[model samples]
Target chain A: MTSDGSGFRAIPRTAAQTRVLDAALTLISEHGVSGTSLQMIADAMGVTKAAVYRQFKTKDEIVIALTERELGTLEEALEAAEAEPSAARARELLLTRVIDEAVTRRRAVATLQFDPVIVRLLAGHPPFQQFIGRLYAVLIGDPSPQARLPAAMLSGAIAVGVMHPLVADIDDDTLRSQLLSYTRRLVDLPE
Target chain B: MTSDGSGFRAIPRTAAQTRVLDAALTLISEHGVSGTSLQMIADAMGVTKAAVYRQFKTKDEIVIALTERELGTLEEALEAAEAEPSAARARELLLTRVIDEAVTRRRAVATLQFDPVIVRLLAGHPPFQQFIGRLYAVLIGDPSPQARLPAAMLSGAIAVGVMHPLVADIDDDTLRSQLLSYTRRLVDLPE
Candidate 1:
């Protein structure tokens, strides 16, 4: 679990690669992976298509890197959670960080999770699949069939809670706190 | 409330228009609204682009109609839920049907809600806006800020729960039942 959560951060990128990923993330959030083009990312970054291609040879590489970066953000929380001895406490800690991360990125990360291309990438990408499996192992703890649904719902709730139109006007602090409490309830954690 | 729920169903369309929408939905489900083009829809339907144009003027029109058609499926449930006197009972009824609808359509309907174009259209389009408002109203009968978050989370839970990769292999009956129970818990209704 420790190694799995750390896998993403271990793969370092150059500053130029990071810049391309940042630009691609913005474009993909707005237009989705299927709708966004390499030329558009280059243009957004004020570079030529050749320059973008130099950084990422293909759109799929950019997408995989973007997902890696996003999941990397959770690496620390996951590490801490993995270290914690108590299952309930680990879950609570992870959920807090997860909610905060979701609120901070809001539309960008949540929206990316739903894109069809990204969905396929996440499934096929080995590191992502391993990292997600670790994330859910802590999230569900019990590993029973019944526990899986609530964990799935909890993940969906947090992802959608931060970005849904219904809560768009909510202040970051308010949304984060609200999500934390509601998510705690969903998992039957003491508020 | 009654009329708002029924608005989607009231809009009539020609058989040709429905065919165009059907093909458009399939393409949009795989490729997003922005990724899909009129020519693609026509190609899928084995018709010329001009014939597809005759059904709908622009890509946005096809998206709008596709959304309407999907929402129309929930019209009956919304109407039934609205007529129920008890708030908790109304919400229970709606969530059950929503879970069924989501599990039945699963990927297509859930994926559409997250599309950037559909999100914008649902926000800007008056009928879509009004219908969503009424749906939320029943879901959160309290009409308070506190209630809004749970209602928002409940919606995300249901949408993401049905379509999430983790639950993808779960049978429709199991998914639907699990969603109903977990969603009821999210809203603090008796399970």
Candidate 2:
């Protein structure tokens, strides 16, 4: 597959930019993008709003950067999956990695993935769309009307599975295994 | 099935309260609970902030009321499922109804269900906790730890399934059918 438009390459962030994104993501995960302000992020970092602004001029820019950072975590897995010869093996490899990441950020996954502002950002931004497209390609392995629902459901299941209150008390190891199994069931992949 | 903690009864709302909730839900769905304000709700309804204060004193009440109102939409179905003699039959009934509701409110479902503010409220609030307990009782039909992951995954799959970008373009009827089928698979229910 061509790397162009695939979002296979990670966006590089300067150390200062990384620090700004780190603080912003914590607040955004708790308060959401609209609820979070550059001032709050600055305060969280013990820096001035202008300092935060120096890295990201607007809240939307910070949000986009945060999304890119999150997506960057999966780039390696996505690339490895794409390189695999067998579709089933490719999906298995990607899903295990996805589940691991989801479990690691159980509390933040839902907000990061489902918050209204992030949802809008993901839909409107071409880079985010390209990244998601690449993820789904490995996920559903089909580009047809029939695959849309399972693809959507699987994505939802994984994102929601990690963060749902019903599973809140579940330890990460158990939650991760469960997410992998149930998501596999949703897509009819072999265990 | 004791009615005391079951949350089977829908919380009633006055006409004015309903107007506040309607306006609040619209705005909150666009901007999350933390992002939405009483003043915004008032402006959306073209009413003074004092007028909104008369109906509900704080933004928390509006959010709680919105959750109750959303749950109220499924009270009848939840009740029917509770009354069903067969466990499998009850799940089928509930899943179909849940799928229908999710399809109907595709855009708002993610925000209402997964927003960090709502998630915290649902977890910490007794009534919401009870309402969700009743829903899960019919959903998993078991209280074991084994059921936790599937329950969480099923809940996530449905909420995310309807609202996820991949399924955004699919028609409601088709989306509903797909959600029901895939969710049933996630829970090992027959199609």
Candidate 3:
């Protein structure tokens, strides 16, 4: 991973940065944080290690940038959730968007989110923590015992639903509708 | 990925197999399915890759054994659920047991379940699919939209709850109770 120092690659105005992100995401997905190297990313991209270094300074930066872009994708939905009239409404809205995003980019969501190394990074980063906190509050409600269990289960289900090995053959449309209907019951939202 | 074909370590026997399973579990949790290999398992076991192969004939078998063992841990609870006279009681029983396992295992359940390669195997495998069908049937009593939504959400929450980098700091008991309470509310189980 190389350093862009821009904190994030400014949307690949150039094809190189886009290639970097695309390659980086797949490698990162396959290799966890500590495991993925610039050489590997470069190899995957059919470029040299230095070629990767030119794109991002260090693996951490690449990871952060990758996360920023991925989270950036969720910004609109998150903003809409924050603006919703009630927590329930916020969750309902987020569920729709979350399902859409997960189904659309099924591989990326699971790989990026579930990577052990990324899991650590997201925890240590304040912005990530805060954003996740907001997301969970909407999905889980107040942190009370009453809300925590369902919240945990609901999130687990969604993460598992689309990517579930069992649900692989279920197709995007079916997965989307099933997830929405199932999670609607989870959060007690209307059909 | 060697296939020891030793059935499951959760059963009442075999110390060496348990040792192997324990090491494999820890390594897989750190490295993921595709990332972890037989050589790694051998090194972890302080044996040759051939020895690891002796326990399991192939990598896929190891994976199946691991999956079976994990599912086996939940078997007694599921059996109780099946045996229960009332559907509501069965649902309550299964959820409680599942929540209990999640809290106890903390990160293991979610991590292994989310790995892409393993997810495929579990789905493609008939026994796993059948077991899960039973699980959902018990968990989801009616196919109503309301019931399906919560079932999906609870499923997401449970997987996310224990392993979530978000809740990593929370103690197991606290996580367990919170998970139980929240999930109960989702299913509208008795407090």
DockQ of each: 0.69, 0.76, 0.36
Worst 10 residues of 2 chain A by lDDT: A1-10
* Tens-digit per-residue lDDT, B52-141, candidate 2: 999898888777777766666898999899999999999899989988988997766766887787777667777677777888899898
Alpha-carbon local distance difference test for all models: 0.81, 0.81, 0.71
Which regions in candidate 2 have their CA more than 4 angstroms from the true location?
A1-9, B1-9
Q: What is candidate 3's lDDT per residue for A15-99, written digit by digit as tens?
A: 7767887888887665555557788889989999988888687887677777776655776788788888888878888888878
Model 2 DockQ vs. reference: 0.76
Question: Which run of 10 residues does model 2 chain B get worst, by summed lDDT?
Answer: B1-10
> Relative to the unseen true structure, what is the C-alpha lDDT of residue A41 in candidate 2, on a scale of 0 to 100?
92
> iRMS for all predictions?
1.3, 1.3, 4.0
Residue-level lDDT tens digits of model 1 in B90-120: 9888878878888998866765788887787
* Model 1, residue A72: C-alpha shift (Å): 0.6
CAPRI quality of model 1: medium
Global lDDT for candidate 1?
0.81
In the order shown, what is each candidate's alpha-carbon RMSD? 3.1, 3.2, 4.6
* Per-candidate clash tally: 0, 0, 44
Kindly report the docking quality category of candidate 3: acceptable
